[model samples]
Target chain A: MDVYLPIAEVSVNAPLLLALGALVGFISGLFGIGGGFLMAPVLVFLGIPPAVAVASQANHVVASSTSSVLTYSKAGSVDYRMGGIMALGGAVGALFGVELFRLLRLLGQADLVVAVSYLLLLGSIGALTLKESLTTILARRRGEPARREPTRRPLWLYGLPFRVRFPRSGLYISAIPPLLLGVFAGILSAIMGVGGGFILVPAMVYILRMRAAVVVGTSLFQILITTAVTTVLQAGRNQTVDIVLSTLLMVGGVLGAQYGAKASARFRADEMRAALGLLILLVGLQMGLSLFLRPDDPFALAPGGAG
Target chain B: MMVPPGPPPMDPPALVAPAPEPPGPVVVTQTPTISAALTNSEIEVDSSYAGASLVLYGAVFNPGDDPVDVVLVVRGPERPVRLVRKVRVAGLWLNSRPVVFEGAPAFYVMASTRPLSEIAGFGVLRRMGVGLDHIQIDAPDEARTVNLYGVRDVVISRLGEDYLEWRRAVIRLKERDGLYRADPSGVRFVDPGLFRAEIVLPPEAPTGEYRTEVWLFQNGQAISVRRNTIQVRRVGVERWLHNFAFFQPWLYGLVSVLLAGFTGWAASRWFRRT
Candidate 1:
């Protein structure tokens, strides 16, 4: 069925949108990460305006992360002290990022900036994840135990001021690192319309040396807050958030995530990670190649700019 | 009143008659008059709206048997359009040199009984803005008025052919989007002087007042013209949401956030129960 989205001012197939949301949601749940990076780009490709796609998908992130965070909080896996500090930094960063996005839009460089950022970030991350996962898988196949990550914290983390103890994660570290990491995640979320969990989990594990048990939970908590803020800001300032579109995506995402989470228990971790890495790499490559390829039409038209 | 004649002949009179009659004294008759009306004056765009097609039925009142062609031009609301040209910059395509058209119609579709070229002379069609090529799209920065031999003439500076490229790009892009179109045989004559044309508004049609001009052409001249309007606006939930987003953006944002949070919480509870 076709439905006209009010804010985007376009008619789109409702079932198609729901299916897209469900597919992305399933991937996110299987990988234990928010799927904003995948959803936003797909929405753009499906004919939603770039800005609207970015903003509206942020709302979907909020719902998915909220549910995940609730489960984590119930299990007492979340580090509130750490997550709160990061969320604070994220809020400020998200506000700044939204304003910057608005300025880029006025300059007519928003789409270029978005595409370039996605190409670079996704390409690098995907390559690293694939290489690491493949190395582990090959080592296991050769009858060797999986290599462990180093537990030692970086020296600079100790050197920073404002040190605080996180009881849940059982860590004593300077608060600045988590705060800065949160700010980075917040900026990324606002610009790329993602929850930034993929980046945050690794950063927390390697940089802050937080416990693995609490890392995912804390990251989800931070993402929930930051994306909520981003959604509100994008809607208020840019008027690009389409609630109807978001709702359709959320309904499918919520159901799909549950099933995906159930299916994750049957799969090996390294293989799943490798598959996700390959998928991300392919998407990144496609977006990157589009910039170099000759366009069908060199001219584009948009309304609402000053004449 | 003269029995509203029958459906038009299949072939043009010129094709069937090879000989021309000797010139005779002109017999002046009643001036031709045209009237048109849309089947629906107001098109409500609800959530189910994909696109809309309206029937524009009209009639030309001419006493004599002089053949006349029907032409209809449907123009949607005017909007300021920014045209961007992508330039290859250091191996990556980037948008550069944006040209702004102050007032360009969001939707423009011209339908006629016969091809515009065959119905009228080039000058007549151009002057009447009968086809896509004749439509005026002006860029303020590239246009100026200068006095040539004591007579003021409005001249459009071409900016060395680059500006013209942007102007044509606007039409080309709009055409690709199905917003601007020209159909040579879109108008059908139900009876000799009665005609009907279908105006199809695509899903991307801008919502506002659409002006449709019906022109009656005879002997390469527009003898009669009639104008009508169509109002396209969002209705029901669509209108409410659009107005809320634009008028009370902050509140709407808050509502969106709250709704998202609630949905998340509800999903968690539902899954937990399951």
Candidate 2:
């Protein structure tokens, strides 16, 4: 059956969208990522306008992260104090990013900018993850100890003012770093149309030195707030959010995530990470190559001014 | 707004006193007349709407014994469209040289009993906008008005031949999406002086007012013409959602967030119990 999207003004196969959402959701659940990064690009490939795809997927992120945050809250793994500060910064950053997105959209460069940002960010992150995981797996197979980096806080991090305590994570750090991290993730979320969890998880682990148990929950908290802000701004200013499309995706994502979580238990951590890294690399590479490939039709059409 | 040239100005009122009537048998010739009506005047685009086929039945009167032909043209609402040509910039394809077409019809469909070329000459068809090739696509920003020779108010594009390429590109792309089409034999004569045509509106049809024109062709000239309108509108939940997003976007956004949050919460609760 076909479902017509009001905001996007496109009729798409309902089952196709549901399946796409499930596929992305399952991967995200297996790898413990937000999956917005995967969903946005695939939506564009399915012929949804890039702007609509980007904005609509942000709504999906809001739902998925909210669910994860609730689960984490139940287990008392969330550091609300830290997450609250980060969300404040993230909200402000999201406002700025949404305005920037609007400006790029008017200039007709939004598609290019979104595609290029995804390619660069995903490519580098995927390469690094793949290299790290491969090395760890090979070392274990050769009966060698996996290399580890010495844990040390940067001198500048301690010098910063406005120190705060996050009792749940057992960390007392300057609030400036966490706030800045949130702002960065928020900007990335708005521009790249992602939940920013892939970047946030590692940053929280290595930079903020937050405990692993608290990192995912706290990041989910930040994502829930940031993506919510982005979705509203995109809708109010750009009017690109398709509630119908987002609803379909959320339904599929939620269902798929449950099964994917169960399936994750069957795979080893290193092997799973390796698989995810390769998948991300391939998606990024495909997007990057399209930029240089000759298009079948050189003329592109838009409904409004100079687009 | 450019319109199909109307019937050559009704033979222009005679300026000089009419000459004394020549003595002869005054045989009155009947003028061909055409009228049409759509089966459904309004097409409602609900959630289940995929596409619609409209039946237009009409009749001809006083269509003298000159073997008259019927032609139907439907044009959807006009909107500004921009066509951008991608160019290689810094080793990447980027949009540039945008040509903006003002007042371009979002949908166009032409149907006739016979091939347009066989029914009328090129000049007549061009003047009447009877065929796909004759539909005027104006780009005001890229064009200028000038008087050429004795002709007044001729619009010419600044890009010269490049403008024609852009115009063709617009039609080509619109055709690919089934937005613009022409059928030489789409109109059928159900009976003497009675005719009907079927217009197929694809799922991507834009919502707005549509104008349908019926023309009576005789001796390779359009002797009679009639026009009617149809409306394509979003109805039911589709209309509500569209209006809500455009008019109350902030509230809609808030509602969207709340709905998603609730769904998420509910999903989590459901899984926990299992």
Candidate 3:
């Protein structure tokens, strides 16, 4: 059935939106990552304006983060102190990112900057995850102990300023690394139109040396606040958040993630990482194609200071 | 502040000469006067609205033996649209030129008994602002705003024929969306003096006042012109959302945040039991 999206000011196939939401939700649950990057591009492909697509996808992240945080918190897995400190740094970084975004827009290169950065970030993360998972699987097959996660602190991260203890993750480390990590991810979030959980989770585990179980909840907690801030700013300042569109997607997304969580346990670890690697590669390739390939129509339209 | 700039700009009685600007359709001076009305003057959109169509019926009166062609144009609200063109620079496609089309109609549909070009010559149509090719638009100063502050208005004057591509791109995008159409034979004469045309409005039609005009032509010159207006607006929840998004954006943003958070919590609660 066809329905009109109020904020988008466009009519779209209702079932198509629901199906996309469900699919993204399922994938996110299986991979334990917020799927804003995946969903936003698809929405833009389906004729939602890019600005609207990005804004609305952030709202969807808020919902998914909320659900995951609830579950993780109940299981006593979240590191609230770490998430809070990161959020403080994230807020400042996001401000700077927004300013940079405006400056880029004035230069007529904002879209290119966002697309290229997203491709690089996703491509590197995908390659790293695939390599690590493959190494772990090969070690298991070799009848050797799977390489243990880093128990010893890296020298630079240990010696940073603003040291603090996180009881939940059972760590006594300098707060500067996590805060700086949050700042970096926050800048990525603003430019790339994501909640930055994908980048944040890996940083927490490998860089800050946090426990993997606590990372999920902590990331969700951070994502919830960042995505909320994004929603408010996009709506208030940019006026691009389409509630009707997000509402439709969320209806399907919440349920799909639940089922996807149930389905994830049935899959093997190496196979799952391989699937995720493929998906990220696909998204990256799709974005990269527009940069390299000659477009069917070179002329595109944006709503701005028109004559 | 008290002294006037010049006497050349001032004109007497020209402003009030157009018959006191009626809120409804105004008629031009002629016996072959054309009048038209849309099937639905106000399209009320709700949550279930997909798209709609409007039937325009009107009559053109002429005592002479010559046949008079009637063309009806239903133009949606006008707004600004930015146009960007990609160019291959150093082995990669990069957006190079940026242009803006101010006062571009959100939607436009035209129907006539015969092709518009056949009914009138290019000069007449251009002056009357009828056909797509002859339509004129005003260029704004900020559209030429460059990242470099020094180069400003110089770019607009330099953007001569290059600007036409942007205009064409605008039309092409609108046509692809089914928002703009110039049908040659969309209108039909049921009999003498009576004509009708159908206009298809896509679901993406923006809510605003639309200008509906009927032009009567004789020997390729507009003899009589009539103008009317219709409205498109959202109702129910759609209306509420539209109002809130435009007026109280901050509150709407907060609502979105709360709703998203709530949905997440609710979904977890629902699924944990299963």
Candidate 4:
């Protein structure tokens, strides 16, 4: 049976959908990572049409980010000006990403492209996060003080035209870093139907060297704007937005985010990173296994066929 | 703000007489020939007398200045049934018209123009299933009369799984006007023992050799009933391939992997410099 969501107009199961949202919400809240990676695959496994799954997951990211960002903001951990500049860049990147997607579809190379990309991306990000968090945990057990050193800021950020001071992040960096991050995140958001938070969070923490407290907030703010724009664009151009599905997912997701945020407060930073790493690894492995598995049936009956 | 006023004048109408012109040569153009083509011109129906509804479809085209009226006639064992007659405007038109008629055993369709215009068309005649007729039952010698539609306290047994089992209540009649109208809603229980099933004879019902078994019950008791046979002629292709491309799950997975990969690659390169 098909069930409709209150807002997204997409049809999916009520119970299963809510469960997925809750699970993802818990993870997102626990870890600074946006749960788009886990949500999109799970949705597809649940028999949602792929396009709908991607688009709806992107929508869910916006909602999830909104809740988390609120918490981070209250903690005085967001760099609004930096985040805004990045978001602007991301919006532009998203436009180009969509065009590239169309061109690939026209060439019938969409499948190969998507498969290879997922295998590499999820594999690398998952590995990196897992390795970093494990090292941090091992160091604490050995009673070694965690190393903290300040490096000179990148010259590119300083030389860029828009130089802005982010008091909270305590950094006076050019807008180039945020803008580039935004553009890349926007492209990824359009193509994968993710909020690009998974990508943004890491970039903010490591590349921009923003404090961990501010990184999550800045990433969420950018994700909310970019993904929301993507949702509208996908709806207007392709008429693929299923409000019913998105609403159902969000209903469960919003509540989940609250619980997730609360639960996240109790966990140490390394624990959150480790969990995210494992989740990403699992998704990556699943994608790889599918390539070798023989499909159930190569052909099936279609509409307008002879009775 | 200030307001301004303007004035205008109107002229009166005039009447004048005009002279008639001399007759000129008359040019007559032949009426454009309207025609239609049948993609599949012929159709066949089998066992029309059985309890089944049959339908015939065809495409009609008009190529003339005026519209063409087309009529369909079916001749069966009992009488002729006029299926339909409709006007076709001058242009290309495809018709999948539906024809419904009552009680007929084997019928053929004929088409013609009301004003005798040239037209062509082709399509198939499909034999849909039979129509159900009214069912009636009489009370047993020991039980009180029970009416199902309006009578309360009537105990009706559960129907069997097979659709044909209910055929016991079907009442077949001789084909008349090459049509039979079945009333599926008229089935009801009058009492416990004696039961009747009604069925409308379709023009394409089988010629002979058929068997059907119907059950009878009262107050949770099974009554006596047996099977019978009637012949039927089947038509049309049995199987065909159905094409469904968009629902393929693998396609989705493949696309997802590629997109994720591209973003990941770009992200790694992007983060390295910083």
lDDT of 1 at A168: 84
CA-lDDT, candidates in order: 0.80, 0.79, 0.75, 0.49
lDDT of 3 by residue, A1-113 (tens): 88888888888888988888888878766666778879878898888877778778888878877887777788888899999888777766666775676555544566788
The per-residue C-alpha lDDT of model 2 at residue B266 equals 86
List runs of model 1 lying over 4 Å from the truth: A303-307, B1-29, B141-160
Over B1-274, each residue of candidate 1 has an lDDT whose tens digit, in order, gives 3634333322333222322222364333354556788999899999998889999998776765667888999998888676677789999998763455657888999999999988988987776677898776656655554443232342323355577677788889989989999999999999987899999999888899999888877777776677778999999999999999888988888898888888878988998998
Q: For each candidate, what's the DockQ?
A: 0.40, 0.36, 0.47, 0.01
Worst lDDT 10-window in candidate 4 chain B? B237-246
Name the better of 3 and 4 by TM-score: 3
Give the clashing pairs for model 3. A306-B102, A307-B102
lDDT of 4 by residue, B1-274 (tens): 0222111111111001111111253222221111112222222222111234322222222122233232333233322111211212342111112121223233322322221112221111111111222222111223232333232433223233522232221122222323233332222222321223333333333223322322111111111122233333333211000001123323332332233333323422332344
Error of 2 at A192 (Å): 2.9
Give the alpha carbon lDDT tens digit for every residue of A1-307 in model 2. 9988887777888999989878877776666677888888789777687788888888887777777677778879789999898888888888999888766655456667776877897888888778878998999899998677657867777888999888998888899988987897788778888878777776787677787678777888888898899899888887888999999998887777666756877998788778878887887787777688877888877533422
Error of 1 at A307 (Å): 10
Candidate 3 lDDT, tens digit per residue, B1-274? Answer: 1233222211123212222333356443233456677788888888888777888888775655556788888788887665667888888788764565667788888878898988988977776667666555556533354433332332332256666677777788778878788888988888777888887788877888998878777776666667778888899999999889979989998999899889988999998887
Q: In model 1, how large is the Cα lDDT of residue B258?
A: 85
Per TM-score, the best of the predicted structures is: 1
Worst 10 contiguous positions by lDDT, candidate 1 chain B: B14-23
lDDT of 1 by residue, A1-307 (tens): 9999998778999999999888887886677677898898789888788788888998888887777777778878789899999999889889988988876665556768777877887887788788888998999999998787777888998898998988888788888988888888888888889888777876786678787778877888898899899998998888989999999998888777666766876999789879878887777787777789888899876433422
